[model samples]
Target chain A: MAHTSNYILGVYDDEDVLLKAIKNVREGGVKIHEVYSPFPVHGIDDVLGYKRSRLTIVAFLFGLLGTSLALTMQFGMMTIDWPMIIGGKDYAPVPSFIPVTFELTVLLASFGMVGTFMIISNLKPWGKAKLFDKRITDDKHIMAIDLGNNQLEESAIDKLLKDSGASEVNKKTL
Target chain B: MIAESAIREPLVTGGKTVHDVTEDISGRVEQKPTKTWMLAMAVSLATLAVGGYAVMRLVWDGIGMWGLNKTVGWAWDITNFVWWVGIGHAGTLISAILLLFRQRWRMSINRAAEAMTIFAVICAAMFPVLHMGRPWLGFYWALPLPNTFGSLWVNFNSPLLWDVFAISTYFSVSLVFWYIGLIPDFATIRDRATNKISAAVYGALSFGWDGAAKTWSRYETVALILAGLATPLVLSVHTIVSFDFATSVIPGWHTTIFPPYFVAGAIFSGFAMVLTLLIITRRVYKLEDYITLQHIELMNIVIIITGSIVGIAYITEFFIAWYSGVEAEQYAFINRATGPYAWAYWSMMTCNVISPQLFWRKKIRTNIAATFVISIIVNIGMWFERFVIIVTSLHRDFLPSSWAMFYPKWADVGVYIFTFGLFFTLFFAFAKFFPVINMAEVKSIVKATGEKKQA
Candidate 1:
């Protein structure tokens, strides 16, 4: 609710129009802070030229860590730490270790990827979201341009947004 | 963009715009409790109270309150355990597997189904812990924690211990997956919240989602990877659960086919449970347009496939038991069909194998009332399936003198009722406080697979 920065937000009703407007606004040499939508507008990232997310790499690394930890824990306990003959099987039964290993791998990978995603995306429980328009979470899509980031005059940027099919353009200090 | 097939039926039937989708889905959450919801909660809470008393008796008076004899030491407890666990599979299958396959129909049902998966697993976990009699100690002992008593670690080689890991991992991971999916939809509710308390609670739950394009891009990637991870996790969960029996020396329990057979049965029962709940939910909530008849038919088809697989597994088990020429194994299958538990076996056959086959008829599968009835029947049959496998196999062991018939005590029935009450209670609360459908996902697909264009 505290106002700190000046901004102009173009409100769009259709996803197709929003996609085109993102392109138009960017081509008009205005820097876009972000585009917000109720749902994931397919190809909006491509139009915005956002790079593909590398969370998968983080997941893979976490999975490897889980695998090794599970192996080491089991092997250390069952084989070296306090070996006891169970069901007359080998003290270190590798095959028997697969189920727990797989479970841990999945557990860590999901938790890791999600944790990394929240940290990077600023989606934290205590964080405050800058709400330019509540309708963005309903039916509207929003293209927010920070006046400080763009070199274009405020009137010229508003004209570009109108020409690009934004239903309305509004300015706010927030 | 890939064009949708011309012949494909529309997934969302109502000509709903984005605003309408949000309103229709979140409308329930924002409203005061309906009379039906109150009545349902009262019934659920009453059941939970009665069951809770029985659980306290069992916990206080020991597991001897149940009719678990020496021979049938694992009767209702294990049967219910496997039954509930199997019932937990369909949610992940719908959300994770169907997503990987690009099945758009799951969009409407996955949220509720995943919710069911978590609740069913909770019910399932209750049995084993309660069956331990001293669950307070058993719970900690089950984990591979370093103990003061000689620093003894849990048996890594035991399937039961593997089960400890599997169930815990499955529960936590499913919860995370469900919560992550709920965040965006929570933001929808949060933004629309008019009351201060409602706004604050939902806002916290939403984690302040801004719906930026880059975040959505990452969100999609994380969802896909989680789906990929969950697919195998679902399959592995049931496989390990089967290992609890398959690794045993019991003639009827030890079979190579148990893994695939149990997995199929899990999906089979899980979908039936989903249908049962959704049919009622859609009726009460009036979400029929989103959960169309087509969704019911498609799920019924899945029931058919998995049900057929389970039927074949039954036949294969008998064939292998006879072909193995082992007297104990042969006697196990014969005793299941012709012995004291023949009633249970045939009920399983009639309900699970024969009943789902009826779905082959288009008329029966498409009828909501029929689907509802059969869905209940399938669940009953599935419960009996586990009963047949566990009690029948254990009752008449090789030592005839030690063999005894297993009978349920009031406590057994009461404890089972407790889970039913608990499941419904949790479900009703979830249906009320949460948006029962994934509004965000449904919105993404509405324009593409909707029966009519946005108004």
Candidate 2:
């Protein structure tokens, strides 16, 4: 089931203008649902008041899981399950386990983080994407403000977007 | 005023605006292949044909087609393996390490370099598998798989087994990382597509990237984490590769210095390959303004540093061999420098050590022609380095009765030619199809200093 919503889309020609407009519209007490740009606008997250991502913490936990699994598997195989005397070394050599352990740690951490990111971003293989403007992926920057979240009238928000240097403003419904 | 003047030079030249950047980079992919590209592809395909014939013959015949005797079992096969693997390292360095260090200049070159890593690793992987006599079975046997053979499992202690895990992990992780970086660029391409097929193809590849700020935030975080994972991962890959030799009982192969030495040499050779490829790529594609001389100069500086480290490692190996007071070890070192394989040793020294010293001069480092020649020389030198280590040491071991000369058969030469064919063919296809430069990353850097005028 899809939840329909209304949004006022403001498009900007320049990133500088977009950056400035993000600040101006926010200061004017307008709620921004999302801002989209072709590339990362460095301070946009801070300007839009987004919290720092916890993906790194998740990556750390995943790394620990990888390390534990690798050590357990190696120790069990070399010492517990099949013990063969080779090169006059002990059956369970910790030093020898380092390479595989390290490789698995990296492998898991990378895959886990990407998986976490996909889930959190709602990026499913079969899910339909919400595209605001095709030009956002090319050269334009866009700001989409949800009508349900904003207290101001639609006309007032449209005037505010124009004053804040939006090249064009369009009403979008989904 | 002086300090302000010394503020870093602009990364992208020719005063390119954001729109111009999109046009310059994506246009290359969308445009019809030029006559030069067609000619180059034709030549590469011909080489591929020759290499293909060679590989087919090797598959038909057994490992006996190669001139490996009981004395020198491992030869050009392993040498080419290590050489190609080393060449793959520079790509990871440029893409992951430089990104972690926040070097903006990497933005322009990382895409091609990362592609080189994937292709070079593909070439490197063929040798170990093919050298196994029965590659079809050996591939599975190397893995620690559950099988019907009673109580038979992969030896956990073997460095060769470690290599199976390391190389595969490195390849998969690098592939994912490289593909992740390509998404936004693919989205850009998708939006710019004039035809339906192009749109559908690029659209699927981009995973429907909507350029939402929330998505961009997560994308940045993922890129950072991936870079962090890949930095140590790249170092470990080469270090593990060196263990395949360093853990052995052979005199020259067993050394405390192997890890660092191999890593440095890998970076040295890898940067050289990057330079070789980029020099031609920049010229043929007319990407002068994007991949500028500054990028070449910076990469050359890296070559000089890694080259010097490799040279130091070489000298240290000889000194340690002499100081160990073991006659066999001393003989191995002496033989490497003055024995039948002395020519190879000297070539390694000249190319790896002496040639890169030319970069110490600012003019030579910055000169495109000079950088190109030295890059090829350095790669040749690194190849000889591996050859010297494997062949020279194994040829004359403890038993003089069993000591013998190893020579390359037509199969040995052909397999290597096949890899070259494989690498160039894949690279040309990537160049023609994918965005050679990371357009989004470049756009970020250029936003502040990009050309204002529309190109």
Q: Which candidate achieves the best TM-score against the true structure? A: 1
Error in Å for residue B182 of model 1? 0.6
What C-alpha RMSD separates each model from the true structure? 1.4, 2.2
- Residue by residue across A1-174, what tens digits does model 2's lDDT show? 389899999999877788889999999999999999888888778888898889999889889999999998888878888888878888888888899999999999999999898888876544445788888877889899999998999999999999999999998886
Pairs of residues at least 3 apart in sequence or in different chains that clash in candidate 2: B15-B451, B16-B451
* TM-score list, all predictions: 0.98, 0.97
Give lDDT tens digits, candidate 1, residues A1-174.
454778999999888888888888888888999899888888888889998899999999999999999999999989999998888889889899999999999999999999999999999887677788998888888898999887889999999999999999999787
What is the C-alpha DockQ of each candidate?
A: 0.78, 0.57
Off by over 4 Å in 1: A1-3, B1-3, B453-455
Query: Against the true structure, whose DockQ is highest?
Result: 1
State the lDDT at B355 in candidate 1.
Answer: 94
DockQ of model 1 vs. true complex: 0.78
lDDT of 2: 0.89
lDDT of 2 by residue, B1-455 (tens): 00112366767888787778889889998999989888888888898899888888887888898889998999999999999999999988898999899888899999999999999999999999988878878845787765456676677788998998899999999998999889889888988899999888888888778888888888899999899999999999889999999999899998989999999999999999999999999998899988998899999999999999999999999999999998888999999999999999999999999999999999999999999999999999999999999999999968899989999999889889989988998999999999999988888777564443554
How much is the lDDT of residue B400 in candidate 1?
A: 94
